[model samples]
Target chain A: MAYTAEKPVPPPSSDELRARIPGWGADLDPADRPSFPRESLDLRPEGAHWDFPERQEPDGPRERSVEHKFLTPVFGTAQPLTGISGVIRRYAYDRFSEGRAAHWLLLIAGDRVDAIESHLKSFATFRPDNPITETGLMAEVKRHPIRSRFGRGRADLRHTWIDPILVAGPWVLTGWLVLKVLRPKR
Target chain B: MRAMTYRGPYKVRVEEKDMPKIEHPNDAIVRVDLASICGSDLHLYHGLMTDLRIGHTFGHEFIGTVHEVGPSVQNLKVGDRVMVPFNIYCGSCFFCARGLYSNCHNVNANATAVGGIYGYSHTTGGYDGGQAEFVRVPFADVGPTIIPEWMDPEDALMLTDAFSTGYFGAQIGDIHEGDTVVVFGAGPVGLAAARSSWLMGAGRVIVIDHLDYRLEKAREFAFAETYNFNEYDDIVVHMKKITGFLGADVAIEAVGAEADGNLLQHITAAKLKMQGGSPVALNWAIDSVRKGATVSVIGAYGPIFNAVKFGDAVNKGLTLRMNQAPVKRQWPRLFEHIKNGYIKPSDMITHRIPLEHIAEGYHMFSSKLDDCIKTVVVPNAS
Candidate 1:
């Protein structure tokens, strides 16, 4: 017989996986079975769709990045505009700055790509309690804030916070495009 | 430098070759003192493995003196005597972290089929092996270890692959005290497995082989019972009758793709390279072992499909465990065992030849001439 990419046996269904789960060990607890979730047990055909594109038009290719602008400070101090608009704008600026720092952290430490990809995969799974999901390694990479050895650490009001409106708006618009415009037929 | 180069199937010659140099920060250049022609090398010798480029050297089990060391090599130093494991693994990979060193994801460019192996074939990452005057070892700090001052170089050479792989084959069987074990094949690895079965507290170890010389070695080395399968009408039935119809508690398939049960399986799998070496031994393991028994396979097979009895294994509820033996992991215990004199691995070495005469050594070994149980090539001899 010639080599075949396909497995000889048909993949087991969720029920079959459940039945076969106990065979790994006689005293394996039923509670332990939940760790290996039904979705994980489904052995989708090998190379069933290897030729398929990484993403379709609906998903628009799983993106690790998006374009955003860093806002320069117009004045060297916080604007004295006293309104609800000022408070909301400041909050958005804080959030965007933190996200930008994380992107810089990822960029500086290219070795942590696998860890970041693992984090992205976990976020993709959306299972909050999947213990196998690694969050510590990701946090460990992000924990030590990026520090410039030279005078690169000097604070500059000109490049302080990313353009909050421009940076945050694209992300929000991308989410809307995905949910409303690009949602494929179920 | 002189090295044994493969010209074609059953054709090998010792030719002048360039001395290897440190290519990576983690690399070390070792001046090979002693190298053994592993049984798995025969897969390439017989032209069973694919992508075996001409002039490729073939030897994985070797012990030598460190000639040079790269900057990242932390454990070894120049002039240190060392034995290198067959696996070329990056220490920090996820698989390496879990002690599954054989499946290390970082070392091999083609990590899906198999991990990096020294001088087997292109299917196994295509790294040159140690069957030469000097070899460049990658990930030197992780895979190669200094041989203890008291240990013999010949013994250390065996530890690099054959003995460790055999012990790993038996370890995966999960053999409990008093378990009846049956090992198929009586080659060097098979001999090692049978011998290791004793170490694992097997009540009775039975080795099956067609060759009387190997069976004789199995009996002497392992102190196990031996059976010539050629003499039996139905080997499985014979096994069943001997084990009170419950069959052996554990079965090990040590014979890989080129198992010789009959003419067609031998012709198709071995000669024609159609199916991954015949599954005759594996089928025998599945049929001969009792239901729910564990089956351990350490045979070297190509990274392709085989005509295995998967349904029989599933229906019998057998636990099939297999992997390329993570050779380095077996070292600590093996070291202690060798220290305690529980096993003397060098006892299996039956012939020793100079590097220049390695072609004749290969021919003698492949032809089973002079009762060649194991052959060691001394590279330094003029």
Candidate 2:
């Protein structure tokens, strides 16, 4: 039989679409591109007209009524590995002791990461279409990533792990020396 | 006027009935020149559609000359030969607007949500059948097709519904550019589904059915590869073998109750991986599609609703589409495709009989006794 290639052909660019069904004005700008309704365009209806079974709606983040000394609270988007929005949302239940009294466990990782490594799936309450806006407990989840990493009173996460790497080896010593030599005197 | 009325189980009487008159502005009175028995019509003959009262006209598949047209009619005129799709449709509706005309709300309204079909049941909008001397057509401008002069009545008669439904089923099955599609039945709709798949550029079509006669016919046409489910205990083994071990990307379950009733019990107990099927073809579309694949089911599902396996369907990311044929909606494209050599759908017809002996034709077809594939009924009374 013939082979099925999964690669999708790129459709027209956003600029090209604007030329077709534009809003009432000319200089409506590039941001206005791709803003159209389902009925307005000849789009291929991808999903099933019928909803999938199971009807999974991931429960929202349970508020933390308790505080523990060793355990830190980690709150982030649902799944870290997949897209943030889907019918099913899964969050990693963190390791806890005694009466397990916490929901979202926020994990800090390499500062360059846009989202936590905890496998980000969308909170069931949040949808891609009608997104849970930048407010409430849901919005707080997003801001934590930006604020903790790069803001007015940001903590240097790099510094915390740097000393350990320095003590761990001869290769680390060579790296520190090379950087120190390259540094300009202030 | 002579009308073929349902007499009893497996019996119909050609008796006199008043000639139909156009009641609506969009209505057209058609003097039926040809009509045929559908596999679904057997559902009534066998008593599946039991609630039908006396004098129920027995056929829906028809093609005829328009005798009268209302003032609002624009596209058609009297004396034009036309094929009437079984499912009447309103140009507007969620189903029609999206091109799923067979499931139109206003047209097929049987006093329910999804709507009714002609000659099916009282539950299905009690529209009369075309298996009569004269029948009234609703939405005349959109309903009838002007049969091409060169085309044979045999080919034109098929466009009515069976061919269109099968074609629609094939279109919905998501055959895509180059892919292997497996069809479960080798009956009329199944064959059309196979042909439809080929037209969509399917690399190989694997058709499954028990009857050696139908299967041999399928094999002759290379209507995909054929599998005799009666011979083999496991249909899926041979099905997968043909698809290069990945299981077919698309599987068409056109055989409704023809498969097995007891198997349903075993399937429910077994795991989804071993199941390899949807109990009902129309509903279990998720079962046939490859993960993140598509399943278009045009086969008749039921007189009542049935539940679908959602857990497996969703986890696999299957896309399911069902309902009646998009006959009117696809008419223009279907006409173009047939007018060209792009699709030869009429090749499935195995029998052609005049209206007078339609009873015997129905008996041969409905009983599947003489191996009648599709019997086209022409009016000899004319």
Candidate 3:
């Protein structure tokens, strides 16, 4: 549940934050900031008449970080949470604040899981993902493969050797597993 | 009224919403006729942006009939067909006074970086976008221009962001006569940049993209030489070799955050959120330019640290110019180009979807399905 019209729960007081975290609100003093002079709020007149904007009604459940009191009045509904990846995303948002590396790492893991799910789903479709064409393997032969890689000041050269293994290894492993499962266990 | 609402990443729907009303003396309510999905909107769609609220309507490039005008509004009247620039800014702002409307301080609360952008995110002032039946436009007198009678509505829509930004991308490059230019990404902005390079006196323009379809579009639309980045082991090296081992005179990094060339960079930046955006194209732009060349970056990126090759740029003496295009600033020149048949902004549009089917539209564009170069939303289409 997220994005209520009610005012978000007030953030912890500066004193409390200062006590809890080291070097908290170090830039809170306007004097400490370089842009403080130019970042004046008095320049623009307050335009909005409402105390808070009219909230758009949510169609379904939306993921909100635990740190926020509620979701912003407006939220996206394009990609609804589903599958294991969704659960991982929900857990990341529900448990961790945006500041934590764990939160972002979990979301990244979720994206990988989602990629695998997409590949699996593609197998059921007529135009399954083509490893050769889609992976740009054909281009290696047609294009100058050796000349472009060797002696070139390419940053990606360090990981170039591992790319094929990382890309094709999963498919090869999946094929072996399928063969093992389908073979008659005599 | 119905509006395109963001449910989550890669998710959007047309939802019933209240009609927008004038909130400021300069505010105007526009009845949207045509709205577009910009290439940069994909960053928001992929959930890469911070503080993007749920149920936020996502649109910025739009042309519509003026429905209502506030008391202080004098430039426009009801029923006036106008195209709104993506940047929302007060005319009197110091930035606006210098023609830097995109960096206006008065409109967006986060005035330190960018000005207010319609439907971008809370980071850009959280202004609801124009992908609705009606959109409330602030600073209406300054941003919106009456659609020229001879201009196609679709062309007017493109001027709102894509075409203007592309033209601006080339303008800022400080391109000299007969200079060789290289543009990265073959998205609408990239194509527009390539097309504009010729206008800026570029002798040779080459566009790079992994997509063959987009490469074909670049050749056909921009009349620029196209190369599929996939067809090279190292595209930057190839670029140098082709340009007599000196590199292009100017390189435009039109591809932003979600560029797909280096797997590690893509995974770390786009997936892991390690950096603000994948700097693959930008790095390539820097690497593939001549020693004293210029690199124009008009691509949208989240405000954060990216692993850009700043040291290389310093060594090469590259003049890096970038900004959110002041759309209205380029309107006068672009209008002339469009009028003289020098550029057809609508020629790039490949799909037109009804507002109800906007969810499908987002999916199609995000996935690059059906070679969707551009998709326009007809909000009131039956």
Candidate 4:
């Protein structure tokens, strides 16, 4: 028996995927059952489409990143804006949800990826009421819908508080701005 | 009598030593009618596993006749034929209750890391092994399997480790009904994995190896299509071509080499590989799975003792399950399969010598000299 890119016992709904992603390459279906497109899972190399894409046609909500700019002041001067903007990806088990699951990110960093990681780690392992003091901000930002905008459409960034100016500014200013909002997604 | 004892670098001695005795109440003394060397035991031979102390007895694969039994022995009387599964378990422990008998705490809590087994190493269990004229079998009722009276010892001897290990490997590979399995390395364990793959209902089984003897024996016994790694410049590409470019639904890595370091490099490579973080072998096997495929590993591994990046596995949506085979859990079915002639896994044995001549058999088997697949030793046989 040969390795049919097609499974011998093909899933009944595989055709749904083919139909849904028109003109997408046939090889798009990864091995194994019920596979999603790599573009959907990895937001880095394929992040451009993880959210609603830039409107080339009638559309709303431009693709936005869950990643945020994190900054910490050294010697009382707030550090420059830096972080993996797309969000750093990882698996986060949700016991309440009833199964182990993967939490993904875009992870676009500016300079101190390491510092941001340490701060997150410290809060995760050391905090008393939970890690929300650290991760809550980032996690909330990640869950917020297209709060920032990029590319061609206002509808894409529609409702997102991400002002166009912030997207284009230097690392320091962006980090300062994101921190200043301090608004919870809720 | 000379014994296969671990000494130093490249030094396994056929040394003079005192014979072992039944130390536990459930113990039995077996006059080893047959025994075989194992690949894992080579770790001691090469001095990679430096903790076995001096003069440690080695060799886990064996078939013996019970010569004596302690007062508590009830399952079998003297003269009953038996094959000792590589590991010994007390049948009661947190691990045992979970059916992971190989990691039994009562029987092996003090000896090795997971649990105790014979002839493997200090890290496994420092127990004396059956590669001798006589061996002491602990937890005899659980460790010694009674072979039917009529079956050939050669055919029953391998029922211990290689077959079980390979079977476990195939089980890990998840060779489901009609699935195509690609097994890496055709050493004894790999051959066994291939054999088990076929028995597990795989539509096609492919065994990969650079060796000619193993490839041949794999086909003759395991019923696998063989791929000689030497024949192709690109093993993965060749494999894909054979599979029509999709890849096998499952792949098993049975070579069990800790190549990352000398003798025992601490299978950090394998551990790292598991994280979807390291090199190609594991990743290749993992990649071979049709998307969302499951990969199980039964290959024994040392602790990588570090962080693991499981992101790749998660992203690929692959589910991997691995553990040392709790042989006791599978013993009933495996024995039944043997009884019904459904599995002729023991036919791979190629050499048999008296217990006194075990040193030579070990050398031959270890060297893979003359295409030796499995070798056994007998003590009292004419």
Off by over 4 Å in 1: A1-186
DockQ value for model 1 = 0.01
Q: Which candidate is the best by DockQ?
A: 3
Ranking by lDDT: 3, 1, 4, 2
Please compute DockQ, using alpha carbons, for every candidate against the native two-chain complex.
0.01, 0.01, 0.02, 0.01
Tens digits of per-residue lDDT, candidate 1, A1-186, equal 233543222223434433432221221222222111212213121111212211111111111112212111000010121233223323333343323444222221221232223324446654422221111112223223233112222211122132233223444775887799767877
Q: Write the per-residue lDDT of candidate 4 for residues B41-85, one digit (tens) a residue.
A: 654443334223444677777888888897667787999988788
The interface root-mean-square deviation of each model, in the order shown, is: 28.3, 30.2, 18.2, 29.2
Fnat: each model in turn:
0.00, 0.00, 0.00, 0.00
DockQ-based CAPRI category assigned to the predicted complex of candidate 4: incorrect
Per-residue lDDT of B189-264 in model 3, one digit per residue for the tens?
9999888877665667799997777888999888788888776899998997777677888999999998778888
TM-score on B-chain, cand. 3: 0.99
Clashing pairs in 1: A71-A162, A71-A163, B257-B277
Which candidate has the highest lDDT of all?
3
Q: Which of the numbered candidates is closest to the native, going by highest TM-score? A: 3
Find the 10 residues in a row with the least total lDDT in model 2 chain B.
B269-278
